[model samples]
Target: MSRRRRKSLPAEPVRCVIERLSHDGRGIAHQNGKTQFVDGALPGETVMAKVVGSRSKFDELRTLEVLEPVAERVTPPCEFADLCGGCSLQHMAGDAQIAFKEKTLREHFAHFGGIEPEHWEPPMRSPDLGYRRKARLGVRFVPKRDSVLVGFREKRNSFLTDIDRCVVMDPRIGDRITDLRAMLYTLQAHDSIAQVEVACGDDAAALVFRNMEPLGSADYERLVAFGKAHDLHIYLQPKGPDTVHRIWPEQGEERLSYRLDDFDLTLKFHPMDFTQVNAGINHKMVALAVEWLDVQPGERVLDLFCGLGNFTLPLARRAGQVVGVEGDDAMVVRGRENARLNDLDNVSFHGANLQGDFTGESWAREGFDKILIDPPRSGAEEVCEYLTAFGARRIVYVSCNPATLARDAGVLVAKGYRLVRAGVMDMFPHTTHVESIALFERK
Candidate 1:
């Protein structure tokens, strides 16, 4: 049997008047009675787009030329903005990007939750560029290109984008992309390096190289010298995250730590641990969560999906007692250690599958006057079922995905909670990924 060949993409450019922006930052237009999503085009703009993909419901196109530009459109700062998938909204003005995210949150609330917030808090803002403190960059050696690509994948493609610098990433690492590429080229196991995981703390930055094979002696020495010369903490992961160990400054603690000066607390974490990409936004976000929860001195609070006591310790400072629950045992342990390091006696952490049957957990039986939830992208559907039982008067939910947040908001509202306040956080600027926070109060 002969295999079928794929259909060729349309070579001709199609004119489109962008009606609106999709949640993922694509411009939506109707062409031939079907919706078309055009990349690199803003809402209220006329553009000529080339079809990259065609489907039954909608077609995907890349903007070839903008016939009419919107006021919000701006020249992208990064040279690789056209190809790099790291940032989708660089072409849109910073203020317009924030507005678009706020619009997205409002739309999700109305469509998925069947309700809207009574009060809209001002969208939290932060530095729009060079603010990313964490990232997992792909590294690929393509012989055809005759060079190793050390950056994010191309827009809507599997191939890595050949970029020398990323404006959105922390300048400490972003500025060294060329140097990193050069160093990798000099390594004997250059192709063996699969990824570079970056983690920046208040005072230092660390990079963990995920090596697919054992590094030669010279390669290892070169990595150490490079780390020393660049003033960076370096580590190698031979297999899994658990295998990540520091190679430079081999004497003291190599843990990366961020300080929350407002709370007088410091959180130390491993490079492989999950953390907010934007440290400034994270600090502000925690402050917002605490302010919204408004836990009184005698109040008991519950924090779900608590990682490294980011919220638990802060809440403990105000509330009488705070209980943090997380699924990862390592994270739970780390949270406890953070609490200990801060001398926070009122805060405790437990490990349990929050999305599964957590009814038997002892923490589930405790009454909470207020609660703070920061679940993963899947949202807290299963946990929402048990929230009402805790009799929490106020709940603050921090979400990375608006759709899931809206869905869970519906469940909470159905349980007699009112959507009191909600807003978006510019945690990830130049990207359509929305980080939102919402408050619900039992009426």
Candidate 2:
């Protein structure tokens, strides 16, 4: 017998004032001795929310009415902002969002790290819409709606949103959302299609479709014709990610690639590989970070969490020697390949789990003059502590989470490093996601 279904809890209407915006862009409010997270609310605003889901400690709600509006709030440009779940903070003005992100970074650093930057670089801003180069789109058939949903998940739900377009995604993907819906609908294996992963480069855009079953010959022909018509490289994943294979009219190139002209670098990535979603700002960020590192010929540099050598190869152009370390061996191998393609022998790779303490002499064995660390959201507390002990003269840290960055900055300051400067990069544009870079010097 099939497993029984779990009934969803009924929603309750409640009125509250949004106190702040969380990192994920959810509005935070407290009511009736409990914390509530509501979507589509701005800080310093009164609103009625319908509690949709609840955990042991907190409840997630949808804003039912805006009783009092905040000055920072603005109408979102995207038609599907509320329903698509692609962006949650779109209603917040761009400037106000940047200010909040900067404030968040400072507060996190002070609270977690017990130190603050002596100087702050202004928040970087860019085009807010159509900025994303990569995204994962869900595929769902809603019988009640009598339509197929080909977009992100619904607000706070696993079910796919019924969307015809997405404004935040790159035009390559957003423009094709409706076409994708139609194409899947025409396929004999429509119910078997699950999702599509999109990745775009300067020259090409690729889409990888996740399917529950193998494609029939007719299904394959339809996909090939579609790829030819759209000039898209289509890959099909019949099972796991490892099973992904191109199923277009032609084999095309084996990999998708992006170019960085500032450092004369070209990085190739698999559809599932981790590359910065915003290519334009990523180049600018690289320039800013390299300028701060001030690499000189014959200087030694260490690049940590170096995925596919995004920063390592660029540093290699200026530094005499650069060592890139990452936890994933596949990334390390790819990084090496990129270095070979660029014909830059100055950079090398090492595989290591960077989140652990580097107390072992072997871990701190490298004699480097400068260090560049771009850690994940967990922050670089362990690595920062190791940096203090290793005594690198200059350290440039790139972070996606301010709270974690602040926490790690405290460790560096305690270890005799001064945060000289920091700034936010609007890599995600309209979204509340914060990407920041900080400089520290051994005092």
Best by lDDT: 1
- Evaluate residue 24 in candidate 1 and report its C-alpha lDDT on the 0 to 100 scale: 91
Task: Encode model 2's per-residue lDDT on 7-124: one tens digit a residue.
Answer: 5765567887999888777899997778988899988999988878877788888887889998988888887787666777788898888887888787777687367688989877
- Give me the displacement of residue 127 in model 2, in angstroms: 0.7
Off by over 4 Å in 2: 1-13, 29-35, 54-59, 144-146, 355-366
Compute the lDDT for candidate 2.
0.84
Which residue pairs collide, candidate 1? none
Tens-digit lDDT string for candidate 1 (177-260) = 999998988888888899999999888899999999999899999999999989999999999778989998798876889998
| Per-prediction TM-score to the true structure, in the order listed | 0.98, 0.91
After TM-score superposition, the amount by which residue 422's alpha carbon in candidate 2 deviates from its true location, in angstroms, is 1.7
- Location of the lowest summed lDDT over 10 successive residues in candidate 1: 357-366
